[model samples]
Target chain A: MSVNISKPSFQPYTGEKARISRAFDYLILVLALFLFIGSFHLHFALTVGDWDFWVDWKDRQWWPLVTPLMGITFPAAVQAVLWEKFRLPFGATLCVTALLIGTWVARIFAYHLWNYFPINMVLPATMLPGALVLDVILMLSNSLTVTAIFGGAAFALLFYPSNWPIFGMFHVPVEYGNGQLTVADLFGFEYIRTGMPEYLRIIERGTLRTYGQYATPLSAFCSALLCSLMYTLWWYIGKWFATVRYLNKI
Target chain B: MATTSEQLPVSLESDSKIPWYLQDLPLYLKGFGILTVIYIGLRLYQGAFAVASGLDSSEPAFEQYWMQLFYVELAVIAVFVTSVWGYLWFSRDRNLDQLSPKDEIRRYFTLTMWISIYTFAVYWAGSYFAEQDNSWHQVAIRDTPFTANHIIEFYFNFPLYIILGGSAWLYARTRLPLYAKGISLPLTLAVVGPFMILVSVGFNEWGHTFWFREEFFAAPIHWGFVIGVWFALGVGGILLQAVSRLIELLDMLEEAP
Candidate 1:
């Protein structure tokens, strides 16, 4: 809770420090410039699905898993710097919020405003709240091990329930051309037809065993456990990177 | 107790004689030898199994091309790492402690420059390139494990940032005395954030390999990655705040009336 410690004695920045900072600033600026230009091209390509755009090949089962894992990169790295140096507890939350904000804003602008797709069909993902909860849990616990074990587990467990309000509506059973399937199956059938056939829908309809209707909870549990294991390793790496013990001036 | 000035350097020199094995040449050579051995071993393994078997043949030509691209990427990364470390080591001044305040600031600035370059490299790989590539993948066909998106996102972007994250930690520890002393929250965030990113990558790739293809905003698989991203942004904000506080202190010192 009381993570902040007394500030260390301050020393004036030497000329070398200023010079290094300026150089760093220039490099950042240049990189930003390139990203700006490149992003536009990327945006255009994404809009039209270029040659290398294989991410569209996945179905519901895999895409959700892959995207968030990739998405966590910046937040975790940022937290390492923030929590270690400034005692900020909101690192994970803030990073997740920014990304979600950016992603959602992009979705709204591109899909909703631009009429690229309907809101109901192409709505932005809603995992940020879960992420925020995870970060808050970690902050409250203040132990990486605990965060990974418990917080990570909670993160996964909360995933389905968190989005159930929106996604659950789609879970209703529907009698279609060949058989009766959940609304989830229909939605996937309608939108993801090419790769995701009706058979891919992992729902319950009384024929299967293992509580077919409880697939959401089972999936969420697995995901959360994986996330916890991931957090444990990354926390240590984050700590390692924040180290400043080996400076030698040129 | 009387000491002779002439014998000082001679006596000190003899006492300072490092063991043969501890000498810089042997150490450098030993490291290089180990690296060489590891590299050869890995290459041999790849040739004997991956290439010798028809596993490589099973992949589509496009996937094979992308795999080659990944190798090129690895080479480029290796070059950059070697160059940066070489520059830092070669440029180090032995008499750094005696530098004046202005000189020290200049040195710090130089170090920051290096750090910025490193950051730029990371952002390009992690954010800009990765995002753009994701957009492409979301729209394209998925085939093989090393699809274009996986190549950029999981292989290139994730590892690059992990390295950058490590570099940030190393930078803070080496340059800033404040960081060198003990753990600081911002510093911890900086270091820990990247590691989480790396771990999150495994989940991400696994999700792609096994599950659905379409990008779902509400999937449990994505929650971990999103959390990590948010943490990284938070770290950035905290770093800015810390720097601002430092600036304010410096300004007050300058204007002391």
Candidate 2:
């Protein structure tokens, strides 16, 4: 019989370093505390259709573009802290994982477990794999600016395809009461009963063949571009957060 | 039958001036014990109530039963405060420099357990409860952003995780010597990214009020949240590095003959 026992190694540190570390720790703590509190209420609002309740503007063109842009802030700031200071390659991955886990878990509990809504009708936004891919690319490159330029573009470009597998089924065309509309149109038809009329869907009808029936390509391109721009700005933010020396300290 | 004293190792019974209890008392009797007991008890009580109420099919219990659960959760948090303070007080003497190899290992295990519990508690608060009502699905009309679901999800759940994420960072920074010297970027990302997302929840809620009445994949109002979500990648990088360093430290310790 073999007994596997391990000893622990303890490192000594100076009091000054400890104090500085404590200050950083407090800053991190303050930020984390804010995140924990904010996500709870945000999920509820999204579920209840508070922020995303406008039907007229809810088109493929703008929705995907904006959601990712807003979401990019965390990853950018986090990356600043991780990449610049710690040379950690998984900042995006961790943040994405937490968000996906939190979002999906919330959706499942709210929709399935809590009977908040039918899963088929309303699902949580899917962005985890894209986040993972971005992190992997950043890890391989080890360059924040390059990652921002390429990874950000990739993040946007990948959104449609990543979500297409799920949302594609809803993209199919359907005729409701003689009005030929895509499944996306019927989404608003069944849910989202606001002041906006039903005829406002940005889909191609039999009479109008100007734009193709699909809008995903254009939407994805715009999203990718926006993501690229966001990535560039956020890279700087990441660097800022990684800054160890404070003005007061100087 | 020979000398029983010969069985003892030279280091085992050799006494320094410091009393053993004084050396290790902080390790075990930290206030965390009582807090843990109270939190567990409250959680159990809430779970039991939910089960019992769910079993009944007769009454149309109020629509906001889920919201009521928040109070029970608050009670659990109150208990956590006690636990944290208690642990801090009891572990004062067991600082990193003073601990023996055995005690150091024990403290690491204890810290891991505390963090794990904290993580679980955060998930429950930030994700689980916010989605409880399903009030949005039930309603036929789209009202203000503060409709009950938004209130719970944006205002309630998002903040809870931010708090947890921040506390976790604080814990690693203040208490652990390894994390004290150099800033752990991944840990910072992990904490900070989530916090930004939490703030974006407000923008997300307000956006829905002005526009985005329907599910559009791309909306300018939602751009803020998408940007926030993207930051998670940076955070992921940092977490991997931190964990790797921890593992390396562990391995180094284990390799020493």
- Judged by lDDT, which candidate is best? 2
Candidate 2, superposed: residue stretches over 4 Å from native = A1-58, A71-101, A128-141, A191-216, A242-250, B1-76, B86-91, B94-116, B131-257
Alpha-carbon runs more than 4 Å astray in model 1: A1-81, A105-119, A181-210, A245-250, B1-257
> How does candidate 1 fare on TM-score?
0.46
Error of 1 at B8 (Å): 53
Model 2 Cα lDDT, one tens digit per residue, A1-250:
9998886685643453333234334434433432433342243234323222232223466556655665565566666666655676766666666666555655555544443345555564556677777787788888766787788877777766777686667667788999997765665567543434455343333432335555656667777788878887867765644433212210
Per-residue C-alpha lDDT of model 2 across residues B104-183, encoded as one tens digit per residue: 33333334434433444444444444334332323323344533344344554455445545555555555555555556
* TM-score for all models, in order of appearance: 0.46, 0.56
- Candidate 1 on B1-257: residue-level lDDT in tens? 76699889787767865431123334333533553463344333332433223123345654455577678768866875677555545654555445454443433443344334334444444444444334333444454556554555566556655665555555544554444444455545544654575687677668867764654323466556545543343234333533553454345333322
TM-score of 2: 0.56
Global lDDT of each candidate: 0.48, 0.51
Q: What proportion of the true contacts does each candidate reproduce?
A: 0.06, 0.08
lDDT of 1 by residue, A140-179 (tens): 8767677678766665566545655755565466889979
lDDT of 1 at A245: 35
